[model samples]
Structure formats: structure tokens, C-alpha cells
Target: MKAILAFAPLFARLKGAMLLTLLLSLVTLAAGIGLLGLSGWFLTAAALSTLGSVFNIFAPSAGVRGLSFIRILARYGEKLSGHDMTLRLLSDLRAWLFARLFPLVPLARRFGRGDLVSRLLADVEALDTLFLVALGPISTAVLAGAAMTVVLALLLPGAAVIYAVLFFSAVLLVPVGLVLASRRAGAEVVAAGAALRQAVLDGIDGHQDLVLFGARDAAVASSDTAARRLSAARRRLGRNAALAGAMVQILAGGALVGALLVGFVALEAQQIDGPLLAGLLLAIIASFEASAMLVRSATRLAGAAAAADRLQAIATSAPGIAEPAAALPVPPGGEIRLEAVRFGYDPAHPVIDALSLAIRSGECVAITGPSGAGKSTIAQLLLRLVDPDAGVVRLNGADLRDVAGAELRRRIALMTQDAPVFLDTVRANLRIGRDGADDAALWQVLEAVQLADFVKALPGQLDAIVGEAGRTLSAGQARRICLARTLLSEADVIVFDEPTGGLDFEAESAFLVELPALTRGRTAIVITHAVVPASFDRVLELRAGRIAERAHVPA
Candidate 1:
């Protein structure tokens, strides 16, 4: 039920292979250890038995050679299985993260900058120790320590017990200390990255304004501050890494020192032969690697734990808009009406209050308003981009809340203020509203939007790459492509957030020819920042989140 334990089921998918590997390694380690103890006894016996060196060596030589062979096999098994388990856990983690992220981006964007990136990239990387470096080595170390203790007790009881106690303390201390050290760094890294992401976003979002105001220096300075914070966090994390290494060395040194003192006392008492004492010390040294690995794994796991926490929050986050299970049916004609609407993105920030308007099935309504007076919000509400806090948005007498979001969206095509051409071909961008639309359909919409000549002249024709965010195309050209997308939708309703923005004389003249064609036979709400089309059938003026004036004219 808890996140810490929740990862178990996902990781458990590879349990069989992991267990197989564990079994192989344990057997391998035990066999190798037995061989070491036996070889040590033989060496001592061979040395003591013969008066001359050559004859003494030959008697125990075969046993020592066979033991060495077993040790080699054990080492191979341990390395192989440990790595296999790590790979499995890594795959499970990556899959789990992606599944959580798919539906959460829209909600996560509202959470603020740097949070998601830290969780996804940095935190996920840290969590790798949950399995890779942690579980296997930790297990191996415990088993090896137990074996060493029993062997040590045979030679010297007090020394063996002390060694076991030191190991226990190191095991307990590793994960907790590493996590505490990394917690602040993980949080800081996320914060700094968020600042970095926001700075770039701000600059790109305001390219025109920044250029006009000559604020390049300010943008660069803000971006540099974000970069500096990121570097500082890295420096802090680097220190924690060094500390983790120091902890490992301390644990290893303690074990080695205890083993040496106890072996010396046993040799003096004649309680064990010389070869056996040497073998016990060597085995402890070999197995100390497990404890060292535990320390490293602990450090890595801390980062991952922080990341998983963020990702978990994102996956479970509820959406801003909730849709009903059963949708209310709207009439065939797509007449739209808003009634006594009070709405805003935030509870304290109602952008439109008590606003009401109605349009017939095929009439065009040009919504004109001062900036931030809710013209775009009206378009958003009608499209169900966001649901209203109070009041109703209706299509043909049916409430938007009762209509399935996907179904309602299908009946409408929106060209929004944030509309930018995708990094796709001209034909590809236009077909966004219409899947499986052929070349003929593409040409039809392009001609209507007065971009046919431009489309024809591009080297790749319809296949040309538009570049990132349609940078390859002029703003007016990009707008025309979006308008063309509306024609392909053939939806009952259309909302244009800003149709004539970023246009030149030639583009405006071209826009006039095709704009009406796109609006024909569609219930339309056109929001504009610039000139309102006088030819539209009706216009509503909004101020302070309410309709201030309405005028009707013949087309």
C-alpha cells in the first residue's frame, strides 16, 4: 500500500531470474569458502609433514589447485546474476514512470517549474539503487558475513561476534544517512531546473515583446542565474558522494582489523593451523566488497526515492476538469448558448461572470473584448478546454458538462491564441483535425486559406519539414495552415482565437479571401486582438468579464 513497498510488486515480475541468480551465487560463494578453508588446512599439513621443501609441496598441491578452480567459478556466477537483476529492475522502473506521466502533463504544468523534471530524470536515476546495487550486494554481504562469523568463531569467538556487530551497524547506517544527505540536493536540483525551464519558456513566449523592448540582456541574466543554481546543487551532491565512499572504507577497515587481531591470538594459542588463519583473513577481505557496494547503492537509492515520490504524485493527480459518465445529447444543429456563466481558472480569479450569449446554428459571432476581459476564455469554455465553476455552456440546448469531452471536442474545431504550427509538413499540420484525409482534401483547405501557391512552391511540396514550432514558415503562413485545419474538420462549430494576428499586407489580403470560406455553414465564435471583421453577422463587446455591448449586421 505504501510507495516504498509498492515498488515490490513491479520489481517482483523478475523474481524468478533474480532468485535463480541468488541461489547460484550463494552456492558458489559457500563452495568457494569451503575450498579456501580446506586448501588452508592442506597447506599447513603439507608444510609440517615433510623435512625437505619439494616433497612437502607435492602432497597438498592437487587440493590447492582444485580449490582455486572452484573460487573462480563462484566469482563468475556472482557477477553475472547480480547484473541481470539490475537490468530487470531498471526496465520496470522506466516503464512505470512513463505510464504515470502520459496523462499527468496537463495537470503537472499547473504545479510549477522544475518539480517534474527532477522526479523524472534525476530522481529516477537515484532510485536505481533500490535494486541494482542494493538488494543483491546487501543479500550477498549478509550471507558472507554470517559464513565468516561461523568460521571466525571456530578460530576465535569474541573477534567473530565483534565483526558481526560492526557489519550490522554499517548496514543500518548506510541508507538512512545517504538519503538525508541527498534530500536537500534533490530538492534544490529540481528547483534550479524549473527556473531554467521557466526562463527559456518566458523568452520564447515573449520573443516579439523582448525584441521590441530590447530586453535580451535581462533574459540572459535570468537564464544565467538558473544555470548557476544547477551547478551549485551538483557541487553539494558531489560532496555527499564522497562521504558515502568514506563510510564504505570505514566499514571495510573495521572488519579487516578485527579479523587480523583474532587470527593472531588463535595462532598463539595453537587453536588453528597457520594456513587456516591466513585463509579466513583472505575470505573476509574478498567478501568486504559486499559491504562497500551496500554503501554505494544507498547513495543512489536516495536520489531514486525522491524521484519516485514526485512521479507518484503526478500519476495520481486528479485533472482540473472532470467529465460525466453519461453525456447529455445535443440537437443536430450546432447552435450555442451561454447562460449566466461565472468562471475562472482559479476560484479567486473569475475571468467571466454572469455572461450570457446565444447564436443560431450557422451564424457567425465575432467576440471582441479588451485584453484579459474573457474573450479567449469564452472560446475555451465553448470548446470545453476548461469547465466553468458555475453557469452553463450549452450546444444546441444541451449542457457542455453532460457532453463527453471527446464527443464535444469532435463537433468543434478551435484555432487558439497559442496555436503554432507543429514541426511537421504543411499537409501534416493541416490534417490534424481530419485523419486519413487525402491530398485532394489538403489542397482544398489550402486553396480556401489562400496558401495553395506557397504549398506548391516548397521543394518537398506537402512533405517539407516545417522545422520546430513551424519556424520554417512565416507567422501568417502558419496561421493559414491552422485555418486550413478547420476546413478539414468540417465540425459544426469553430472558434478562432486570433485569426489576423502577425500578418503582413500580402498575408492579410490572402486571409480575407479564405476566412469567409472557412466560416461558412459553421457556428463560429471568432476572438481577435486586432481588427474585428465588420462583415460578420454579429459582434459582442466584453469588459470586466461581462458583455458590455452587442451589435447585429447583415453579411
Candidate 2:
């Protein structure tokens, strides 16, 4: 509940619209009750009217028509305002959540992609019911119930007392019981639904591997099991809601009978007329319509609460690295230095230990080591993806920690083996490097990476759609496009981590041939186990978190 309330500030932004919607909803409910009451009174009075008797037909007839018009108009306004507010709120919330998620990336990868997607898409969507189910309905029920009770009391105080008791019992007590009963099951439903979604997404993403590994059947089975569990949870919640609804209906029936009895007694004592009795009875029935939605709203409360908790887990989790309160500006020259830097995912096992290195401005260096020698870790530290545990990594004489991550990244771009290629047009992918780069600049970078000819041959050229993760392009083509993107950046320093991991001899050689031109007048760090190009100014080998060897490569 507390987690759900954390969005109060967001709700505050639409307070004006929400208040308007509430007012309209109240009017709609009131109009409905008035219409039913007026119609019943007019019909009964017209039936009892004798031939040529003096009956005020015009007034009641106009009242019925006016109430009907009000009901229709108010209902339309209520739905229109309510849905408009909901759409705006949902749009704002999605953007806000993504903004929060942006700074925590790479470290946020600890939560699997499927799980994160589920939270972003499904969990956030579940909150739509917060306004539609819980807030609007509950508020309308309270106000309408109170207003009905007062109106009835004006006519028959005894009938009003009975109506209030039954109304509260149905709206408050029964719903509370339903909430209690559905809380655990509703939570289970939400959790199971997320799990099922995750399983299905994982299967789709890894279906090839599953099939090759003879595990496709197992994957299918897992998804099926999750679906069954989700279905069972949903069924449980449905049963609770139905039971609560039945109880409300029973209470409403009792209120109707009580109203009838009270009306008959009052009429016999000459306290009220026949038409007034009929009107009051019909109004009591119509009032219960507003309270009818309360039970369903209460049942959904648990699921909404569960979704809020899931979203809060991501919202409140601290980022991998904290931003400095006062960040230093990036220096003009790209000089990187690591002094006694030590870090590891686990405290007991350090990846980089007491490692010290320095690269002069605009120097090209190749760092080579076998697998798990902290080659990639060095790139991560320089980019400040993960902070060093012990010593300092500095850029242009300022500690990386003292500079904002975005600023540091602006000065130093990292291109990895698995650089993500989004499912968008080729122009969109290239624009990620330089937001406003024109077609000429794009072609220049593409040519530098020797991929311009292939792209130009495509039917759509720059506008060509690249499939998810660049699956539409060959592996070597994808890697070169990533390099072209990196080259498009105006960063003074660039780091490549196994950039040619899956390339063949010819592709690697072609990339190496262009290495000198690509790295000219820029600080470049190539971290890989593959053959280092002879054009590098210096080569260093890392072993067990230490620089074990250093050599100069002849130009």
C-alpha cells in the first residue's frame, strides 16, 4: 500500500482533471437515481389518476426528461474525463520509470532482460486499475450512499436508517472481507503472470539454443506450468469476487424489502402518498447500483498493490555507481590513468588488483590477455560503469568518480563485442552516435569502417530497417556498423573490447588495416585476446590482474 501511494506526486499532477472526473461521476450517479425515482413516481401517479382528475402531469413529466438528459450527459463527461486523465498519467509514468532506469544500466542487467521487461510492460500497466477500479468507484460509492441516505431521511427517517445500515454493510464490510480473502491469491496471480510472461519471452529469445540443446520440450513445459499456475490464481481471485458480489446483492435485496415495508407502514398511517412511496423504493434500488462496483474494486486492490511493490523494487534499488554532488568538467586532453585499482564482483575474489597504468594523450594501446584476465574490467572501470573498490581511475587528472558518468562517457566511448543494434532504421542506429549527424557524415563514418558500399546497396539505404540485435545483417557487418557508430562519436578516446571476436581472418585483417587511420589523433585502447595489430604504439599483457608484459609495436 505504501509503495502504491508513492505515486501520489504523479497523481497530484492531474489533480485538476481527477477532481473534474470525480465531480462528473457524482453527478452521473445522482442523475441516474433521480431518473429512476422520477420515472417510478410518474408511472404510479399516472396509473392512479382518475379520468379528469387534477394531477400535475407536466411537472413530473418534465422532471423525468430533465433527469434522463442529465444522466446521459454526465455519464459521457465522466467517462471521457476519466479515461483522458488515465492515458496521460500512464504515459507520464512510463517515461518517468524509463528515466529512472536509464542511469542504472549495465549494473541493472543483474535483473534479467525478461524480468525487467515484465516489470516495465505488465507491472506498470496493472496500475491502470488504481484510478478506474479503486479510486473512482470507491469515492463515488461513499458520496452517493451518503446523499441517498439524506434524501430518504427527508421522506422517511426509519427507511433512511435501514438503507444506510445495509449500504455500509455492502460497501464497506463485505468489500473488506473480500479484500482480506483475495489478498494472498491476488498477489499470487500477479507473480504468476509475470513468471509466465518471462518464461514465454525467454523461450522465444532462446528457442534456437533450446532446440539445438534438445531442451525445447522442457522449455515449453516450463511455460505451460507457469500458465497453469497463473490460471489457478486467477480462478481463486474470481471466486472471491463473485462471493463478495453475491453478498452485496443479498444486502441490496434486504434494503429494498425494508424500504417497501417502511413505505407501506408510512402510507397506512397517512404519512406519505402512494406516488412518493414508489419513488423512494425505486431510488433505493438505483442507489445500490453505484455501490455495486465496490466489491470488484476491492478485489483488484491486492493485485494493484502487488504490481506497485514490483515497480518499487526497481525504483528504490540504488544505482551501481553514485553520481557526485558536484561533478568536475571533462578535461580537454584524453589522458587515462589507473592507480592501484582493485575491484571484483565478489569481495573475496578481486579481478583487478593493485593495477597501475598510464596512457599519454592520443596514444593507441593494445591490451592483450587470456580469458578472465580482467581485460574487459579495465574498460568498464575507465568508463565508470563500475567504480574501483580500492584506488583511483582518473581521466585528464580528475578522478572518474568526481566527474559525472555522462560527462566521462562523452569523453571516452566504449565499443564492445556485443554492441546492441536496436530494431530500427539504419539512420536511427547511426544517429545514436551523433544525434544530428547528416547523411554525408554518416556515410563518412560508414566508409571509414568500410561498410558504406554494403549499406548503399540496400534498397532503403540509410532508412533500411535493421532487425532486432542486427540479426538481419551478417555478424561481420554488424560488428563493423558498431565500429562506424563509435567512430561517429566526437569522443577523444575510444576503447574496443574484442571488437573482432567473431570475425574471420579476412574481416579481421581488413579491420586491422584501417586501425591506424581509425585511431589517428585519438587515445585508443584495444582490449582483446585476438592478434593485436602491429600499428599500435604499445602493447601490454595482463595476467592475474597485473600487467605481466609490455612491448612497443613498430609503426
lDDT by candidate, in order shown? 0.73, 0.87
Specify the highest-lDDT model's number: 2
Q: After superposition, how far is residue 513 of candidate 1 from its true place, in Å?
A: 3.9
- Candidate 1 lDDT over 216-293, as tens digits, reads 889989989999998898788778877776876787688778877877887888877677776776666666655666
Point out the worst 10-residue segment of candidate 1 by lDDT.
Answer: 102-111
lDDT of 1: 0.73
TM agreement with the true structure for every prediction: 0.73, 0.85
Q: Model 1: runs farther than 4 Å from truth?
A: 1-4, 7-109, 116-130, 133-162, 180-244, 266-283, 346-349, 420-432, 435-466, 499-502, 532-535, 548-555
C-alpha-based local distance difference test score of model 2? 0.87
lDDT of 2 by residue, 1-555 (tens): 788899889888999989999999999999999999989989998998895368878898899889888989998998899999989989978987888787787734567665787678777777864887787888888899999999889998779999999998988888888878888897888788778887998899999999999999999999999999999998999999988899999999999999899988999999999988998889989999977888888877777888888888878889878999999887698899999999998868999899999999898888998899999999989888888889999889999899987788789998998898889988899888989999999999988888899999998999999999999999889988888888899898999998887889878767765776787988999887766667777889999999855666543
Q: Candidate 1 at residue 137, lDDT?
A: 56
